[model samples]
Target: MVRKAVLPVAGWGTRFLPATKAMPKEMFPIIDKPVIQFIVEECLEAGIENIIFVTGRHKRPIEHHFDINTDLEKHLEHAGKTEILRNIFHISRIINPIYIRQKEQLGLGHAVLVAEPVVGNEPFVVALGDVIVKDEKNVVERMIEVYQRFGKSVIAVFEVSPKEVSQYGIVSCRHIERDIYILDDLVEKPHPDEAPSNLAIVGRYLFTPTIFEKLKVTPPGKGGELQLTDAMRLVLEEEAIYAIKIKAKVYDTGTPLGYIRTLVEFALQREDLKEPLLDFLKDLLSRDIPQIHRT
Candidate 1:
């Protein structure tokens, strides 16, 4: 069973400026819960016992959110908010997370390396905190299933438009079945025409301990920071690495525009706010402003 999982939250979210200047992007909410919470729930559902968080400075809020607040708990109990108190208790009882600071702004491979002391020789899952994907069967659970069946490393993949292949790590694979591929090669951020295949590796992975060895040999690529894709390429030669196309909508909530769209989607799904939000939109669209008004 995959008992340990790692989440990297140390990146400077420069894309979501101003607001993210002080706030960690992982805490950005989707519906009523933060994106990281969703990622944690997915891990828990997959029987993950220990959550190793690779964090950095300015990420104290993420730690606080997972810590116990005696004062707040007492106050809630005194106020007689029984239901709310229970919810707080539930949140407080979540599996305690282990935090490791990554002082340097290295790449994703480096972030995974920080947890080496804790992960040691165990096969673990790495879920990117900023990318949120939801499905009926937890994404981690699905990945775990594939890992057990093949007894090898597995990565979550999605088919992206050929034109947008440069935005993700493209996977080249041999067809085994519908939505399942035998990964042959991986290329990070390849141009549209230069891509190996249309299958894009998303932000979730199930990796074997041997991956650490490959990551150690993989040199820094395009950026000074080591790219995880480079490490995966080296390991692919020895053991099997496969990709599973998940049945979920993935939200790239790390960007301002993506964040705004996620907020709107969540708001419109609420029963209490749907009518008011629709009415407001209708009013704005009915305005006398000219169609050519760019603003």
Candidate 2:
């Protein structure tokens, strides 16, 4: 069983600037719940026992969110807000997260590397805090199953358009079975024509402890940061790595535009907002959208 899971959320969200200046991007709400909470809940549902969070400065809110607040709990109890109290109490009490501070905003591979002291030799899951799948358990649970079957690290991949390959880490692989592949090579942000295949590695991964050794020796590549793709390719040199194509909509809330779209889409999925939101969209589209020009 995969007992531990790691989440890295230390990057400075420059793309979501002014708002993220104070608040962590992962704390942004999808309807009523925060994005990171959704991912943590998904991990817990997949039977993940200990969740290790690789965080940085200005991320205290993330820690406090999962910490107990006896005053608030007592107030809620007295106010008779039973349902709301149960929900929050579950988060602070049940999902006890272990936090490790990454003093530097190095890179994704570096962030995962910093959690090695807690992870030890066990195979663990690394989930990017900003990425959210509609049903992440569908991916995490399946990754756990594949890890057990192959005893190799498993990465979640999904088909991206050839033109969109440069935005993600592209993988070269050999077909093994339904929605599974034996990764042959990995390239970080390759151009469309140079991409090996349309399959792009997303933000979720199940990695063996050996990956830490690979990451340690991985030299900084694109953007002068240790890319996880670069380290995974090193892992491929020693042991086979598997890729599973997840069939779910991946919401990348890394940029302002993506965040706005996710907010709207998530709202549209709610019963209270579905019909009303559709009407609002229809009415807005019927009017003229004036384009603003720089003076």
Candidate 3:
């Protein structure tokens, strides 16, 4: 069983700018819950028993978010807020949360490599803190299903437009089954013309222990930092690596636009917030703007 999962949450989140200056990006709330909490809930739903968070400096808030807050629980209990208290307790009960400091703002591969000792000799899952997968069947759960069948490394991929392939790690694959492909090659952020395929890797990955060895020898690419795509390519040379085209609505919450989109999407789903939010948006859209006539 893939009992352990690694969550790399150490990025500096430079894109979010001033807002992230004092707060970790993962702590940014989607609505009522922080973004990282969604990722944690997905892992827990996928039967992940141990969550090893590869965090860095200024990520103490992420750690505290998952830890037990007895004082807060007591206060909530005294205030007769049982619903909120139950939710708080549920956060601490879901899984075993472990924290490991990355110590540097290295690339994704470096972040995963830092958790090697904790994930020793186990087939594990790596989830990016900023990616939110919204699907009836959790993305990680589907990837685990694929892993169980193939007994090899499985990566979550989605088809991107030819123009957008340069923004993601593109994979060359041969069809093996419905939505499953044998990953023959991986190229990180290649030009559209140079890209072998439009299938791009997303944030979720299931890997065998062999990947740690590959990560150790894999040289840094692009921005002089080790890339997870590079390590996975090395693994591809020796073992069979498969890619699954995810059937999910994926939201990249790392950037401002993506964050706003996810926030609104999530808000629109809640009964308490949906009507009010929709009405506010409708009112804003209905207001006419004063036109400036040009000579």
Off by over 4 Å in 3: 289-295
What TM-score does structure 1 among the candidates reach? 0.93
Question: lDDT of candidate 2?
Answer: 0.89
Name the better of 1 and 3 by lDDT.
Answer: 3
Model 1 deviation from native, Cα RMSD in Å? 2.1
Model 3 lDDT tens row, 101-124: 999877999999999999999899
- What lDDT would each prediction earn against the true structure? 0.86, 0.89, 0.91
Error of 1 at 25 (Å): 0.8
> Candidate 1 residues 1-295, lDDT tens each?
7889999999999997777888899998776678888788778778886899999988988998778898999999999988977866776577669999999988999999888899989789999998878677688888888888888899999878888899899988997887677898999899898999888887999999988998889899877997899999999889889889876777888888888887887789899989999998778877887873444
Predicted structure 2: clash tally: 0
Model 2: ten consecutive residues of lowest lDDT: 286-295
| Model 3 TM-score, 2 decimals | 0.95
Native-referenced Cα lDDT, model 3: 0.91
For 1-295, candidate 2 gives per-residue lDDT tens digits of: 7899999988888888888899999998888888899789878888895889999888888998889999999999999999999999988888768999999887999999999999999999999998887653478889999999999999999889889999998889999989899989988889899999999888889999999999999999878888888898889889999999877898888888888899999998889999999999788776766763333
TM-scores of all models?
0.93, 0.95, 0.95
Over 4 Å off, model 1: 288-295
